[model samples]
Target: MALDRFALPARLRQSRHASLLLFAATLVLLLVAAAWFTSARSDLAEAYSHVGSRQQALTAANQRQQEAKLRVQLADSARSLVERASAGGFAENEWGERLINISQTPLARDEVNHLLAGMTRDHARIFGADVFELSVTRADEGLFDTPGSKGPPLMLNLRGTLLFRTAQSGSGVAAPVAALAAAPAIAPEAP
Candidate 1:
């Protein structure tokens, strides 16, 4: 069975311009589709980049919020500790002595010495305390020594330096510090 090659039209057989026109149209369509695809890909990439940056910014903000919260908590805890220390240090009826509230009163020499001795004895971490020097300047001519004084004694200035040593926690342990230092380092175990 032989197929007839001249079955269509005389115009198609005479020239190849129609076939060239068809090819050109197809090429143009392909180029247009390629350009559209490239533009769409670039837009998609830009959108993804924007979304990534937004996510990073959100993560950083959350971390900063957490840090701020932790700082506030720490400050509150420190304030509470200071309040407790102040209250326990100078209680109203401390040392079984019933006296007036002297938190704001200027302390006498004897009273200051008593307080220092009490602190040295009561502190858990302090091993020893020594007052190297105590200097006081009296503003009035005859304040405490005089029998008739209207107001309390006026002190111009008072200065003192306290030298204290902190007690080590594991000083009584069996292993000496020198021996521990001389010992070889142990390798960590594998997981």
Candidate 2:
């Protein structure tokens, strides 16, 4: 039931200054902590803003890529030179190949001209393919018709050409070109 403070230091008993100083120091430390927290929050917000900006930029880039692909597709299907030829146009004479060749690949004007030019050059010596005599007619012409009786006879008549030059028959170095074979008869249409 009794408590005793047998000893006391006189300096501590008389001085309240030390306690006040300790309280002030604690307050300053709390202020410093608050300031640091505020600055850290601002930095976090800035980092998030940068991430959003980069995402927006990436989205815009993807949109541009899609648009480019669409333009390429449109170019392929429309207003192309090949499409024009398919829709009833003739190869330019300056560009036309004089002689035709059996081409397995899709024929371009350059290829056609190559075949024709080659034949034309070869003919000057033996084949005798006079360009002036070679007729340039409309899509609706007889020479182009495939030889009948040569296949399933049909009326669609995909008209083509009947080159009447000194006919090609593996000529020049090896195969002999046609020897003015009698009045180039129309091959009999298949019955």
Candidate 3:
């Protein structure tokens, strides 16, 4: 009977050792599974974060495109408005007739005299005393000799200067002298 009891105790200890080993193995597997699950979750979160950032970038680009289109439309509308105002308000009616008359009309001697009279009349400080000599020469012959010349020979050169009243003091008190002195010097034209 004693021998049987000792054998029974030995068997119980062997079973306990086996159960402990199985429990340890199961714990190790659970730890590995938990670590793998955590890693997978982290990877999924990173992918979702990347997708969200890309979406934000795409939205920004779309907004920029919309803004650019709006600016272009606004500029076009403003330009059209300016064109309409200039065409309809100020230069619409007489502009064409004025241009045609300027191109077609040839200046006459009476017109030149009237123009000069008007100029002297406008400035009250100057009076024409006498026109010393008057000469008129046609300049159209030389002008038309060139190739590609348009229009008829209509140019005339008038050489004459009207004597105007001036201060006898001959000092710089004369208005004509002041005007000539204040006038800007003509720059030589480019070749």
Candidate 4:
């Protein structure tokens, strides 16, 4: 009976050791699985973050493209407006209307005359002042009309010989057209 009791105690001790070893092995396996799963989940999250950033960058690029298109459209619109205004002869009409308004208004005659003379001088300077004879008249008076009736809207008729004296060019009118304009000289022009 003592021999049997001792064998039972040895058997119990061996069983307990086996159970402890089994538990340790199961715990090691569980730790390994948890580490692997955690690392894999972190990698997936990082990949998703990168994808989200790329999507945001693409959206910003699209917005920039749309803004560039809008800028181009605005530039085109401004260019078209300038072209239309230029084509409509806006400057000439404005000058004409302004002249008519000034003449009709009760402004000082001397002031108006001074303004006209200055404007004319400026115009002549722009034309290089190399003009031989500049005669302006309104509408077509035909190619072979009388001197008085022929020409476009004749605001003024200037006749002079251009002279370059001391490196400066000037038109020396022997007889002023305006001076002749006041005095009707029909005998000289008529047959």
Candidate 5:
């Protein structure tokens, strides 16, 4: 009995050892599977975050591209407006005649001064023409001292190259032709 208690049967001992080994192996495998699942979940979260950031960057880039395109269109429209204004020959001639008439009118000294200032500022807006080197002076001599007249008769002296649009060239593009406008020293007689 003492020997039996001290030593188990070989088969039973072996079976107990095997069962212990199997339980240890199963615990280790469960731990490994848990670790792998945690790592996979972490990797998946990082990938989702990276995708979100990339999507935001792409949206911002698209917005910037749209803004750049709008700016280009605005610049093209402004250039077209200027080109059209320069192309109209009759409009320029008519604007010149109107300026001549305004200058020939006898107005008060202050009024003439205001008109000259307004002409410089409003020429581009009203006539759609740019006038460089504009000079306004009294046309009639000793007219400032003349009685019953509001002020001296004025003359408009326009000097500088005018931007004229030439006919379509060989490239099918209308080129700007600069022509010097002759400035008359004396004012033309009123019709």
Candidate 6:
């Protein structure tokens, strides 16, 4: 029923200096709050930018790691292929026959195709030969379609000249060119 209890005190309500001081302190507090907000927003933006850059760097590092792993796998595959060829009774710089046996399993199809593609694309480089020739034929007369056949269905025949490079006269230069030849045969092994 009475609003007098909520009224300002008489001395403070009548003082202009007190009112001006309160207004100035309020303005200062507002300015300080504005400055703090600006600083906090900028800091938050910088943190976000830093996180984005770090994420990009991490993605790049992961890609590089994956590429390195792929390279290692490719190198290992090449090494194993070369070792198998070497074990097939062919010596370096000699004309000899190499045999590769392929299985006709679904699991081996990709490997077989990859091997054929490599042999066709880089026969000379892969075999370290100067001259190379390749031929493919069916190993059996539709035996794969038969119920009893267990052998592979394809064969590859290769011919080439093998060349072994040698360091010449302690100079790191290659030796003079020489004649070379090589041959490879592929067939299905008995199951």
Candidate topping TM-score? 5
Q: How well is each residue in 160-188 modelled by candidate 6, as lDDT tens digits?
A: 42233343322454443222222223442
**Of 5 and 6, which scores higher on lDDT?**
5
Off by over 4 Å in 4: 1-14, 75-191
What tens-digit string does per-residue lDDT give for candidate 2 at 152-188?
2222111123233332222323322342232222242
lDDT of 2: 0.44
Q: How well is each residue in 20-81 modelled by candidate 3, as lDDT tens digits?
A: 99999999999999999999999999999999999999999999999999999999998888
- Which RMSD does model 6 reach against the true structure? 13.8
RMSD of 4: 16.6
Backbone clash numbers for all candidates listed: 0, 11, 0, 7, 0, 4
Query: For residues 54-119, could you state the per-residue lDDT of candidate 1 as single tens digits?
Result: 999999999999999999999999888867854654321221211112222354545554544533
lDDT for position 158 in model 3 = 27
Whichever of 1 and 3 has more TM-score, that candidate is 1
lDDT of 4 by residue, 7-65 (tens): 99898899989989999999999999999999999999999999999999999999999
RMSD of 5: 10.9
> Which regions of candidate 5 are displaced past 4 Å?
1-8, 89-191
| Ordered list by lDDT, greatest first | 5, 6, 3, 1, 4, 2
Q: What does the lDDT read for residue 106 in candidate 3? A: 42
TM-scores, each model vs. reference: 0.38, 0.34, 0.35, 0.36, 0.45, 0.43
**TM-score winner between candidates 4 and 6:** 6
Instruction: Provide C-alpha RMSD values for all models, in order.
Output: 18.0, 16.9, 18.6, 16.6, 10.9, 13.8
Question: lDDT of each structure?
Answer: 0.48, 0.44, 0.49, 0.47, 0.52, 0.52
Model 6 misplaced regions, further than 4 Å: 1-15, 91-191
TM-score attained by model 1: 0.38
